[model samples]
Target: MINKRLTFCHENWSLREPFRISRGVKTCADVIHVAINCDQVTGQGESVPYARYGETTESVLDQIEEVLPEVEGGTNPEELLELLPAGAARNAVDCALWDLMARWQGRSVPELFGLEVQRELETAITIGLDTPEKMAKKARMNRRAPLLKVKLDQENILDRVRAVRIQAPESRIILDPNESWNMDILRLVDEELAGLGIDLLEQPLPAGQDDGLREYRPKVPVCADESCHTSQDLPALTGKYQYINIKLDKTGGLTEAVRLRELALGQGFGLMVGCMVATSLSMAPAILLCSGADFIDLDGPWWMAKDREDGFNIQNGIIRNISGNLWGGTEKAEAAVS
Candidate 1:
């Protein structure tokens, strides 16, 4: 049996700018960092508290504390599934275990999971909900990026899309309403958004209120973010959502996230790997899931004022390589030239 020192801490990272969704606005990212010290090697992971899921920093910390005894007594990642419900707390502990196990076995997490570590990935930069001119300015700044994820709310839907489209004419656009739209709003934007060169629409209506999507199909592929969390969600999301966004924070960790991806693929759902505004520690493990994703939204760290040491290399819109020793392997992975 292996004994490990399990510990968790809460850290708040100030975002470079305020990020807004359908729910609210946030100026900082409150994250829980978990570390497992086994023998001589130490592994680390991070999870951002998501209010949309009714999660708070204090609540997640308590959840980790509840399972500390078992975690320190050599409970592996697989066993953690039964111990905690899928959420931010379990995600931190599970990823920490995976990181520790990878180092102990002398293999990277991707290699251990039988995945080829992606060398270059095109990730969508997020433009938070704001005034049309402001959002358009943000889009103009990132016009060189290959993909831009525009955050929308109930108001300024068309204005936001039109402004961003004019500013970043060549960039592929995706809309993430974050469950702020109703049937009327969806009906209102249908014709215009279809011609706005948008590639995807995410969570237009509130979860459980999205049954209307079954009868209405828009020109752009619609994705599920707040609605789909685990593999169990794939069944109900069949006709409603053409794509599903996979975030480790939502699925608990990479263990379940990988499982969700396989099941999602089996169900003919397009996969999009996303992340919250956390650190490199959180985003490191998620990079492996972007292998064949139709859209990648791992720009959480880009919104931070400063990220953890040796973060992923992002140039324009492309994420070139995973940096640092956050996950498996050495401090630096061989990066392709940008």
Candidate 2:
């Protein structure tokens, strides 16, 4: 048996600016970095603890600690799903195990799963919630971006989206209400949002309260974010959402995320791969699922004040390349993290 060791710690990276969503504002991304060492090789993964899912830095660390012995004792990602429910803790460990296995076999994670990596992926540049004029200003700045994800809330929904649509007329726009809107408000702005050329509407209604969606069909395609976590949640989401946003943090890790993608596709649900405001380490694993994704929102690293060295190169909403030294690649060892 190979001797495996596990080490993890909490890290906080400051954002370039306040990232506001329907829930609240975040100036720093609190993440947990997990490293597994075996046979003189090391694998690493990162996860963000989101309070919206009842997760905090302390809770995530404690959860990882609970499984430390099992993880070091050769617990694989498949067994990990039975150990922990889908969440941030499992996400960190599952991804690390995948990295470790890939390194052990002298292959990249995508190769291990028989996936061909895309040289370039067009991602969505996110514009956080702010005043209408401010949002428009941000949109204008990123007008050249291929896709723009605009955050909104119940207040001034039409004004904010319209402002962004006008500023970035050529950009494909996705409106993310983040579960802040109800059916009444959705009906109120559905026509105007479509007229503004909005491409997608994400999680407009709060989870468990989205039954109204089954009866009301909007002009724009709707996606489920907060409403869907794992494959178990997919059945109920049918007829309620046109697309499902897959985030590793929500699915526990790439292991389950890949399964969720296949299952969602089989069920006729469109796929959107997204990420929390984290470093490239967290985004790297999720990149494996972007091959057939309808929308890619892995622009988390772009919001950071500084990212890891050899991180993803993202410009104008396009991810040019993911360095080999980054997570899940076979070309080099794990990138140094400070």
Candidate 3:
């Protein structure tokens, strides 16, 4: 087998345009491509930004560059956990290795990971920053998407939710305030979200503010996004959140992500798999984590104006090519031996 070297270039995909949220957004998301080659076949992975962790595209690139020697020297994903902290750079390299190992052995990643199957996962299409009316319009346009995640800032929470609910009355909604709300708003808006048929609310308050949520309850279940990263972040979140948003970038890569999901499920925390704006290569390995996830939010690549050559497909909001079945520009399905 040809031991493939890790060589990559930065890709900047412009959002068809910038979609603002209360926090902020840009016209583009900087992505990194990580590939593993074994002479006979090559496998790839991708990753994106996580500003919450003070990570920019430049920072992520720098992290990978720091680990250049190890990755080239044939660092396995297990050893990678020590070389790099959990973030976009590590996520790409780690996932690339898993993909490479699977392809080299002539097995699907899930199969090699000892996973039963890569089932159909329903994903949530995000409605980025717009006035309440415009967001409502966006929701209306996504008629085929089974679920819609309504992005909220601290301001005008109810108006935006009301608008979106009005446009797609039959659809299920999830509200993500990106850690902008507090105990007060959470209580005030609880009734409104329930009336609008919102399924859940995610990270309404800043991570530190979660202490305030202790002993307090809201009408809808609150999920921890920024507050919960790995299993280590779970202990403090016990009484506050009923759900946890698992992201490989946050946990470093799929290696720890799977463990975190199992731990979260055992702790009675519902699961949601979310993503930053990345390519299909970035989302491919994450499909494995969605097996028991209650909500799927892998819509990062779909927002890009142009994606990588072998990215997954999002049909009517359902992730059609998530398991790498539709990759490499071929329509053939990869089946496991009976």
lDDT order of candidates, top first: 2, 1, 3
lDDT, candidate 3, equals 0.79
lDDT of each: 0.87, 0.91, 0.79
Off by over 4 Å in 3: 323-334
Instruction: Encode model 1's per-residue lDDT on 1-338: one tens digit a residue.
Output: 37689989999899988898777888998999999998888888899878779899899999999999999988987899999999999999999998888777766777667776666788999998999999999999999999999999889899999999999999999999988889888888888898998999988889999999998878778899989999998889988899999999999999899999998988899999999888778888898788779899988878889888777777788875574376765443213211
Q: How does candidate 2 fare on TM-score?
A: 0.97
- Model 2 C-alpha lDDT per residue in residues 1-338, reported as the tens digit of each score: 28999999999899999999988999998999999999888889999998999999999999999999999999999999999989999999999999888888776788777766676789999999999999999999999999999999989988898899889999999999899998989999998889989999999999999999998888999999999999999999988899999999999999999999999999999999999999999999988899789899999999989998878888999996675567785664322210
Give the alpha carbon lDDT tens digit for every residue of 1-338 in model 3: 44667766688778876767778877887888777676767767777767778888788888888887777777888899999887888888888787777777666767666664454567899999689888988988996788889888878888988888888887778899888787887888798778778898999899887787888777788899988878889999999899999998888888889889889999999999998887777777778788788899998878888876656678667876544542211122244511
Distance (Å) between predicted and true CA of 105, model 1? Answer: 1.4
Could you tell which candidate, 2 or 3, scores higher by lDDT? Answer: 2
Residue 59 in model 1: lDDT: 95
Model 2, which residues run further than 4 Å from truth? 332-338
Quote the positional error of residue 278 for candidate 2 in Å.
Answer: 0.4
Summed over model 2, clashes come to 1
The clash count for each model shown is 1, 1, 1
Looking at candidate 2, what is the lDDT of residue 31?
Answer: 95
Pairs clashing within candidate 3: 86-252
